[model samples]
Target: MSSTAQTADTTVTIVDGRVVTPDGVIDGRVEIGGDRITAVGDSDAETDTVIDANGQLVLPGLVDIHGDDIESHLYPRSGARMDTEMALAAADRANVAAGITTKFHAISFELDESADRSPELAATLTDAITDATDLLVDHRLHARCEVTQKRCVEAVIDVIDNDNTDLVSVMSHVPGKGQFRDIEAFRQYYENANDRTAAEAEEMIDERGSMSMATLRERVDRVVDRAHEAGVVTASHDDENPREVEQLADSGVDIAEYPITLETAQRATEIGMTTAMGAPNLVRGESQWGNLSTAAGIDAGVIDTLVADYHPPSLLAGVFVDTEEPLHERVKRATANPADAVGLSDRGRIKAGKRADLIVVDPDPTPTVTAAVVAGQPVYHADTTIEVSR
Candidate 1:
């Protein structure tokens, strides 16, 4: 992402919550000076504002590496479009309400002019998200490049050059590879997403399968190299095997976004790349698509981050699930790990001198965000009656 501009005279103190840290959760308070946390301990120092957290869970702001639910925001229904500015703002509110303070909006480039995802639409979405900064959260762009869509390479270059893209991941949804190994699943996805008949979907799948892997690899390498040159992070989407994982890591991929199998995730981690799994899979207790279970990967200690995937609530909910690690470690996977993978080291942890992006959640059996402080500003509070003394 980008650096948050430091401010002045915006000091705040949060007290009476279980403050989470790398060491563990502590019954303490935190101090914020301007946009950075000045202390994270038993400090009761006075400030411009004091937030009584009501003995809630004070955690680091969640950092989601990849989430495309905004696609529904931009295109909420079939063949319908909403105002981009309004949609972005609304998406931000939904994410923050779910305790996500940072998001990498996954936008794809499907250059067949399908109207759902195209070069033009991706560019429009980038501009819209960038312009809607009034929203109370940090927004970054993740350019998902479909190398098979060769026509969109120039547009991808355009976005990397002009748009505020934080990460770029290679994706190939061919029926026999990547996320569409099951031809039936692939057919259903194409038919539903593109309104194609079964025969037409099969025909398109066949066409995509017949494409030259060498050509796609060359184009993907170009995009990856270009992004790397720009100091932007790179990830590979839904790799199916260790060999593919090795190749992607060799291609300068810094993270593995949803490797499809246990072996792939393990190998990615072994090769020093952060492995991410969908939070929805962990929340649902299984992978509905018959891929690797997120909880299994976590149990094996192969996964390092959990993304919202499509649902914002899953990020917050996945933390409370029974993991072998403590609450702080679970929060780290959703916060510090993903942020570090995307080169955002400033706002992920609840440490002194870190940016003050934090959330107060009632850590009951069913958790909910009570308040969110972005850059030391209380932008969202669930119960306005609970006053924040100034």
Candidate 2:
């Protein structure tokens, strides 16, 4: 990714683009004075730099509330680990290149089944993210706690108390429920991914799935209460049914992420919780694990945000997929909707007096991000250089 810095006195203007604002799309210019957008529409001042969008769509930089791309960076190959700072620096560039200005790196605090998701690594990464100051994209933490695991809950609570997490999502990944409703499927996943025999996989699943409903509720309430006290947003993952989602809502969960069925998503919306689906589900037109498709959720009007999940590129690519929804609304799924969902009101919409986090998309030429500006600085530019004016 290309990076450039601008002085505080510099004025950057993006001209000749179809700017996607909160109200609708408009043919105009966006002027950035310092780190915030100073004007949207015509500008009469001579600028220090100009990004000629050339009729492309100028959109708000994506606010991805949940993306686990950091895990992939740390463990590119099985049993291989990279330095924490190196991985974070790489993830920052990858996200900014994909038009994600603000990224919440989803780190798992789970029972130590996988080395990458161990609580030890989670704490190390939380500290690394907290210390990093030279990242191009705005990076934050989304602590995902596996509710069935007491150790995981404790790790998440510790992070909340220390003020390290921006968002917390509680989930139960026990076999025969939630994401792995089919016990055999869960067994096969372990056998294939973990090099475990079928019998060993089943034994492990049974051991992990033995938590009682009362214990699960107690854990969820504990995490939510701690998160609320810290003023952090909370979410429930892989909600499977209306009753399950209702329980989460009643317990003060603010968002329902990746509900497994259309009915579950509808219930989440009905109960006034922000609903999110994976952008990969929308881009690929289906879920890998046979969950509810993002398109179906959008059609039902149950999904309020589209997150990067595992694939950062999918966030931008998913917006251009063929859908009946207007372009502006589709854009909101990646931008305004997620920003609002996470209680981030400073960015995610292209307007005056907001953070100048913006991207220029050339839609006809395969949805390329030609330029990305974060905090009023040109952080990334594609190989096809955009025209500049003095």
Per-model TM against the reference? 0.96, 0.96
lDDT of each: 0.86, 0.89
- Residue 125 error for model 2, in Å? 1.0
Would you list the clashing residue pairs of candidate 2? Answer: none
For candidate 2, the lDDT comes to 0.89
Among these predictions, the greatest lDDT belongs to 2
Query: For candidate 2, what is the TM-score?
Result: 0.96
- 322: Cα error in model 1, Å: 0.8
User: What lDDT tens digits, residue by residue, belong to model 2 across residues 121-149?
Assistant: 89999999887778888889999998888
Model 2 regions more than 4 Å off? 1-7
